[model samples]
Target: MTLTSTAPNVFEAGLPTFTYGLTATPHDILDDLRTAQSCAPIAIGPLGPEILSYSMARELLRDNRFRLPPGITLAAQGITSGPLFDKLTSSLLGLNGAPHIRLRKLVSKAFTPRATSRLQDTIREVMNGLIDHVVDAGRCDVVPDIARPYPTPIICALLGAPPEDWPLFVAWTEEIFKAFNFQPDVNFDESAIMRAWGELDDYVDGMVAERRHNLTDDLLSELIRAESDGDRLNLDELRMLAAGFLMAGTDTTRNQLAASVQVLCEHPDQWETLRDHPDLAMQAVEETMRHSPAASIVPRAATEDVEFGGYLFPEGTFILVNTFAANRDPAIYDDADRFDITREDAPAILTFGGGAHYCLGANLARRELAEALVVLTRRLSAPRLVGPAPWKSLLGMTGPTTLPIEFASERL
Candidate 1:
């Protein structure tokens, strides 16, 4: 995979023109985008959409004039859709303004400080149990063995689904996310994606129906009972929210966990620092979020003519905020490219985004990553990567698809 930028012509003097090859990986593309960001905070290019830097990206996300475009659809983009499209487009991620606010308010309770704090013990137990499975083996692939398997169960428990059904959830999510790939030349298996979506939708609908008859002490049940003023989520909204929570909460965390482990292993000094001072696990998680964000890009569309950073963006212009670059902005962090867990004053990264559309599961993700690190460091002695971790080529989400590690066997 190769990415090359041609020298700017006379008219577009300062701006570099990027040309991305079909084989370019997401990280490679991001590297090019970061270089472009350094040249200018905002750049207009021929190959891709306009790219925004850290400050400008933050501004664009917070501004009401920039919104999630309604015209963007899986079907319109030549991808088949069924319940997946309906659920995602109707959920909080797809909406803006009052409707988004109302749904967010209702859903926020499940992710509050108190709520997430209560799950620490559960998360710890889950992580340790996963480690326990591989402790005797002395070697394991962290992605499939641990990271990929951990989050779905935790999210399932929170969503009032059976923990035993996590593997099924993972399978469905894998298929559904295929439709999310944005690389220019990638081809998704539309039939498989739609099939998985239908199965997942029916499964969620069943859970919703069961919950309505007999509510339980779970986030899904609470959402079912939740009322804002005189309004409540309709059946479609309920199903969508439940499915969205599972998908959104699990996917990013799964990738982040794998990426975090890969980063820690690559930088042994940092890993040792974390191992020695277990309290710094959270800091390590923050640093990982900054240095190697799992979700690399966020897309937005201008609702009205906006002029900023010496560029005029007409309404409907799509903006791609390169968070992978923004988090590594040299202006924002001293020695930004280096991964240092001890840095105390690092600014918040755009990994979870900003303003109105900030990730609802941010706290949960932080806790999960921190807990995974704590357990890994505590249970294993100097775990080393088996080889170079292979990162996924997906555009929006970037992380190791396989992270094999070997460590001294230790009893829990």
Candidate 2:
């Protein structure tokens, strides 16, 4: 893969400094880089070296010089020894080389798209039920009303856990992600992260033990089967993998769904197109992902000194591939700024990182988003933001934390 930069590498030439924190939304930070026009394909910042273009970001993700950012991330957070740090360093997102490949293969084998697809009936039911609550209200906050609660039931069912325990899983995963956030403030809660890890790990162990006696087609059972294949999958490995799935399978899809809804509501014409023709749900989902990805950045570190795109990345250099910027780069997409859902042959969505670390649940996430959109566009019309929809920090899985909208409920 060619690692050409759209501009001179920032590390050598006039280094454009990019800054990010709780003070600004991720989009605002990236927009500052765009507005200044001083930024290059790679911008150095507090978060990490920002990969601002498509080609460089994609290939570098697959390059051997780059690796998962657990070591660097742990150092940044001042968390060196604990269950939280260990989980950060040991999960699929943490490992590199042979172990990552082996574990990824086993997890991938169990976490199949077919398994998620089988739940189409359940997906529709969940989506419709969530919408049912707001159809009469004529206005609702999309995040808590839909996004936060939607994934829990689906993920719970997949794990063969009780659906009513969504709040517990949600709380645990929220703390779990704090360990990997690219930016954390002075108030970072180490205890919460450690506590969540411990509780979730123990709960997952119990669940796995209980499910082993009655193996079935659920994801937990499939993972158990993967372990039984004599790959020497141990208890911690199995438990952490399941916990990782709970985090990945929920938070990302939730944020993404909220982001997509926020984007659609903000763009009435696009929302109208989606509402008029529900068949465009998949296209709308793809466009939403590219335009306003839930995951603004994915982290990686330089495993060895490497010259990429005419820039030297010293070993242990932390980098954040800015999917938010790459998805909008003019060099890749025509009228890259436009929110048109009818885009013809727009590039493959880099919203999900490329290479091995590319999100395993991406396909399922897309389907879930599409199905939700179908239900939404069917039941609601002309969704417009009711008030200021506040967004979370861009340093991690970013999206509208609360998307209050007023839509004419056709079903109502």
Candidate 3:
């Protein structure tokens, strides 16, 4: 079942060209996944050539090794020379096994359910301010106004970033997603990224030094105090951990919020369902993750020869977990395409991923979304979309970039 060269004619005529074709694009991935899940759990790639899917992606993420393409990984190690688009394509998420697991675990403590729950009141207040800003503007771009600001404030605050520098943190974090090959013809945003990293690193370094000098209550302070078997984080590890958290929590949550709102806008009945029932917002967010996950394709490289779904994918093969497709698998979800908040049996969506790499930020993300939906529905008198919704071209994280909407005059 393995072929050396590219798979031919597997794509639909006139569809947009992408690594996963319709399966990867924001506009068409959901339907593509529903179709892919039924015909075969694994199929010849229309674009990725020899790539294969671990058909049971949702149930068995740990069954295979996930790594980035060697070429991409090597290229990523030298990110600064290039732009943002070029550097992030091969960033830390590309690592597999020990290194990936180690890095993820080093920072998991901050995103624990207990940790995020403590921030609920703060999250609500943050959402309140952002939504108020939107309402006051009368007509506003929800992406930058609400979606963009919400997550970074929480991340920056948790990381002990200064209030004035928080806006810069949000701007730089947002650019990382755009620097990869997903977009067309634009060079990477290297200067902004390097600048953001330097500012953040210096700030965090000072905070760490200060915390070391005199302990404090913040996460950065805690991380400095945390030790495993008398082993503390080295300076580089702390920087990586801080950088990773900012990257993981900020833009990712922003996209999820924007995508959730876009879905509600596209299906106003769903919006009404959420508005009427309010509780439906929880399930609605889950459905959006299933149907339009923030991360579309997860890249993995074979650590050794492996077999799955009757195909023997060779070692070193670049495999992609088409989570968007797996989430909509008919075998796993009934009527996967229909946005049913009350379906009651939605499978564990791949939005948080699974296995050792499962998102440590899961609870934090959910809590943020819960607060956001609650505040939006409760505060705005009648929140309505005001213009054509446009999506961001950032491949790794795609959502509405400009969602102009109007709320009642009194909502402000």
Candidate 4:
């Protein structure tokens, strides 16, 4: 594959291109990526790791040679030791090989189809209750009013966290998510991050202690008692796992829900399709995920010097898989840029990372999204955007911070 003419323009413009650890306007960047995808399956930069194409992105995720970078913990960039250091270091996202395999196995049970199936009623109740709050008003900001609050109670219930502590968990997760920004030049407040981590650690430790004495049906208790082949998660591992699950399930689901509503409102035809064929809730969620995945970029590092797509990626090279780009790769999907729920061969989207590190909470996230759409379409009619939805500027997850929508007023 050869580099396209647009490649030179990306570097010359100095606009903090997507691969350069900076957040660009996603639509514009995606257009550039689609053009580039036609020319090559991979593009190697002067100083950075290779930028993967749609096919290459899927391949590299399953490839063992490319592993998560070591020391990439939630302890901020420069801090070596802190409250979040041990927890983040022990997280499933930060580990590989035997450790990652072991932790994932223990936690995977909670997110299984059977397990999430049990939460169907609870999820429906949560969605309906949220809709009840805004139904009378006839309009509401999707982010704070609906999407932001919908998942917390469910996540808390799954984790055996106290419902009252939902607000605190939200605060801590916000601070923790900042550590995920991969931009090399971004500045983070080490002190505030450490403080949040400290408080969260103490809270999680208390929950662990309580669950150890009295196991319950919740996920946290299950993790405490979970054993396989005489192996179990240690104290620190339990705390980190609980915290990680909370953070992982919360913000990403919030963003995806908001994005789905924004997209559906913008495309009335698609919204009507969902409203008419409520059974297509899953397809609508999948379409939203394909069109606008929560996390646009995922980072990985080469464990060893290896050649991929005819380029030599040296050991320790940082690779950024532009998921937003690959999801829209024209070669992979017909009319890839358009939002169409009825695409027969929709092709799997990499919104959730693939292979050994596939998202543990994927089932739960899907259930939440499907249920939210089902309830919304059934309760509200002719939902449309009140104004332009503004997106968050973070380089990691891409979604609207405020998505205001107005719909025909009707009471269930």
My TM-score estimates for the predictions, one after another, are 0.87, 0.90, 0.82, 0.87
What is the Å distance of residue 241 in model 2 from its true position?
0.9
RMSD of each: 5.2, 3.6, 5.0, 4.9
TM-score of 3: 0.82
lDDT of 1 by residue, 1-412 (tens): 1213343322244565575653345567666777777777766544345554678778777888777654254643554446656655776778888889988988875455655566777888899899889999999999989998888888877776776787888888878776555543254666787788788888988888898899877777778888878788887787778777877888799899999888888888887788889899889999998887788777777676656455556556777676777777787789878889999877778889888989988878888889889888878777898876878753556788788899886734
- Tens digits of per-residue lDDT for model 3, 1-412: 3445332232222223233443235565444444444455554454342222334675446664444553252243343334443334334554566766665565664444444556777788898888766676666777878887788889877777777888877666666443433444254555755676667677677778877888756677767766655656777667767777788888788888888877776676666677668777677778878766677666566665555444555666665676766666666677766777667866577768677667777877877887787677677655678787766532456777688877676433
For model 3, the superposed segments whose C-alpha errors exceed 4 Å read 1-24, 29-33, 49-55, 70-94, 136-138, 174-181, 184-192, 276-281, 392-395, 409-412
The residue ranges of model 1 lying beyond 4 angstroms of the native Cα positions read 1-14, 26-34, 45-52, 70-77, 80-87, 183-192
Q: Please give the distance, in angstroms, between residue 68's alpha carbon in candidate 3 and its true position after superposition.
A: 3.7
Name the better of 3 and 4 by lDDT.
Answer: 4
Model with the higher TM-score, candidate 1 or 3: 1
Q: By summed lDDT, which 10 consecutive residues of candidate 2 come out lowest?
A: 1-10
Give the per-residue lDDT digits (tens) of candidate 4, residues 257-284: 9988888888988888888898899889
Best by lDDT: 2
**Mind sharing the TM-score for model 1?**
0.87
Task: For model 4, name the residue pairs that clash.
Answer: none
Instruction: State which candidate, 1 or 2, has the greater TM-score.
Output: 2
